[model samples]
Target: MDQTTLTRPEAETTTAAKPVILTGDRTTGPLHIGHYAGSLKNRLALQDTHTQFLLLADTQALTDNAHDIGKVRRNVLEVACDYLAVGIDPAKTTICLQSHLPALAELSMLYLNFVTVARLERNPTIKDEIRARGFGRDIPAGFLCYPAAQAADITAFKATVVPVGEDQAPLIEQCNEIARRVNAAAGREVLPEAQALIPEAGRLPGIDGRAKMSKSGGNAIPLSASEDEISRAVRAMFTDPEHLRVEQPGRVEGNVVFAYLDAFDAAKEDVAELKDHYRRGGLGDTVLKRRLEDILQALLAPIRARRAEVASDPAQVHRIISEGTQAAREVTEATKREVMDALGLFRL
Candidate 1:
């Protein structure tokens, strides 16, 4: 037998495999340009290269919306529509509702025992969130324990790659800690390790130039926004303050219109020219904003049309989510079984 040419009975695993990627959006409302620059757009492209799972974090949403579940329920489809509108192909990406997966809830419960109240309190992500929500003094227990829930979302799918921004970096660290502690306690590496895939996303600002663009902040351009709406939002966008006059030298340094261009504008020369034109004076804020308007429309037109087409049959959009959730749970349940057995969670 020629060693080089020999073909054994058992074939070697030579096929290329894409690692699991878990990323999600809370069902607060429809995703927007921030979601595009921050996550959704990347998910659509990543689906081509990796096995991606896009979660509708309804369960996580409830951590804060426990008192107002109606908002969460209503926005579940809104979030799904946002995903579909952003070109997250359901065929290429798994779009799942988090609440539909019992394994996540079970895994969260088990992981909860591993994390301490002090540890949860020390979670920078949770702490900052608590402060932001004015829950510092009256924090809900569920809201505080969400890192455990997030860890469940991650490990339930055995996702190895999580796309996160800088602010959420601590959450990933917390997930890794859970994996480490659980593995040590169980004496087995049942849960897969996860890491962040920080893409070169120029952090997009809100219409008001607030540091972050968030739906809750009410400064977002929803992915499903109409062309007219997009135009209105863009026209209302904040630009250089000192650039009061058309001939005034605009400070492109902090101008959000230019920042949007920097994030969404694909043409390097065009963006550079626009930046120089604004910075050197003689360019009106209206002119720069209109340029951004046209540029944004070019990108969002197709998405808006597609969103309209899908919005007509919201039921179909939701069915896709339900189907993906079921398929995802088939895998999540298998992982949960292994995790449960590792933790000695037996039914006797």
Candidate 2:
């Protein structure tokens, strides 16, 4: 596979046309600030200019949460609520349910043939996740094959752009490889290759200073968290332990508080000054935590209120999802037909 196909050319910009963007969250839990800094903020910005589809990926969630089906089922609404709460307008972005789109599943099954098991195992994202989850040889087949499933999701919509974290860029590469293989076999370009759009902030670390902030890790501050919850999470944030005394110099390089501030605090100059002060001594963790707490409280207040308002009517949320899923079904089914025709499948 040519590596050049993985990204759009510099000459082709979004200004040329409204590109299709496919992005979503697994129905694992409520979204957090990590999600916001990583992708949600980009989604909010892209919805107006691009044809964006926000998938409530309940099916993908099952790859890891299969043991607790209830958790995956319930968080579908929770994730959708978070999307709307964060200002993803249902009018601009098509917010669809993954399970409801049978075409995506069919496409996934078809795409698996175009990719090799060895290649799947070699995927950097998959390798890292398997290690993190300690799946060992007991790795679930579905979990191992998620890159193909993700490829199906991306190509089913003919998406040109996919917003993902820096760590997940390999998945996009795998997706394009599958697309190229399928197109090669069909003797034409059946699926459009996609480019991964990595956010500037990259991945946000957990409050405990772990590499990634995740709900299961109990280190993520959910967007819907109450003011008290936000305050407590900030207070417990991991910082330089050696800086026990206010007069001791602190290291900001690996401090989770500084990481969050970098991701959230709009005032870059002030944060830089604070970092310098901490490094030179005289800055305390308490003061830093207080600053982060204030920023988070202000940021989440409106999101929490909007989430409460939208969640108050379950039927309304369901209707919004159903409508978007119906729309997605039409789009994905058409692509499935195109792919089938490209492969000369019988049209009985």
Candidate 3:
């Protein structure tokens, strides 16, 4: 791939004062604490201040889940419920279904010309997913070109800020590359380059002490998990393996329990005391798990309750998604028209 394609267009050198923020997740499963720490909380904060467009990326989910449409369909509502339960006010945040925007596909097709196959293959984020999924040679074409589609998604909204985790920084870079190339080719700034806003909390470790929590890995505590489920997940969380006994000194490093505490527990002094005790050979996993469970239950009680309330009225949930998707479609249409005009391509 030519590196020049990734450079920012000379005509578009400055950013918008109040940037439009776009961030979302694949609708493969219900969201979890990882989602909360990584992007969901940021979305909540940005919704009131910036023009936010949250996407339920059903189409992207299909790249890996084409064989399981039912799972994806079920999760669309589950994820939406999780969003509402987590206080993403739909009035402030436009939550849209990715598949509803046909223009995104058109844009992706056009953007593909700007990005090379070699460049897409070199994307660290995509490579990580490919390895994680064990796709190897059997990787789907759609999965390979996901970045192009993502660029389209971001540029369709003219997103200036994309809140993401550290791992997704490359994805933002790829999106900007497409934006730069598209605008430069058009001889005008047709798309705005997006910057990644990585969260301070970064990746939350899974209950199994994995580098990152994932729904498919069965290591995630879903945002909508019941109190009992949360408790069970907490109890099973991976702690210091060498500290087999309560009296044995434990290692705090790579301990999933401690990781969760650092991420969620507000009792800084208490958590520090507990960690000290564990390090010095006193605290047990049971005690630490209990503390985590209490803190998590308290934090998630209201979210779970709200999710229950939202899930009760399926029609209302559908209505919200329908309205949001329609509104998003209009935005996508306008963006598509501009892109076509810039390319001097006739719209059918």
lDDT of each: 0.80, 0.88, 0.86
Tens digit of per-residue lDDT, candidate 2, span 67-133: 9999999998899889888988776778889999999999999999999999999998899899989
Candidate 3 matches the true fold with a TM-score of 0.92
Candidate 1 clashes: the total is: 0
Per-candidate TM equals 0.90, 0.94, 0.92
Writing each residue's lDDT as its tens digit, candidate 1 over 5-37 gives 111111111112778889998898888887788
Among all windows of 10 consecutive residues in model 2, the one with the lowest summed lDDT is: 1-10
Pairs of residues at least 3 apart in sequence or in different chains that clash in candidate 2 = none
Task: Show model 2 residue runs off by greater than 4 Å.
Answer: 1-17
Ordered list by lDDT, greatest first: 2, 3, 1
Which candidate gets the maximum TM-score versus the true structure?
2
Best by lDDT: 2
Clashes of 3: 0
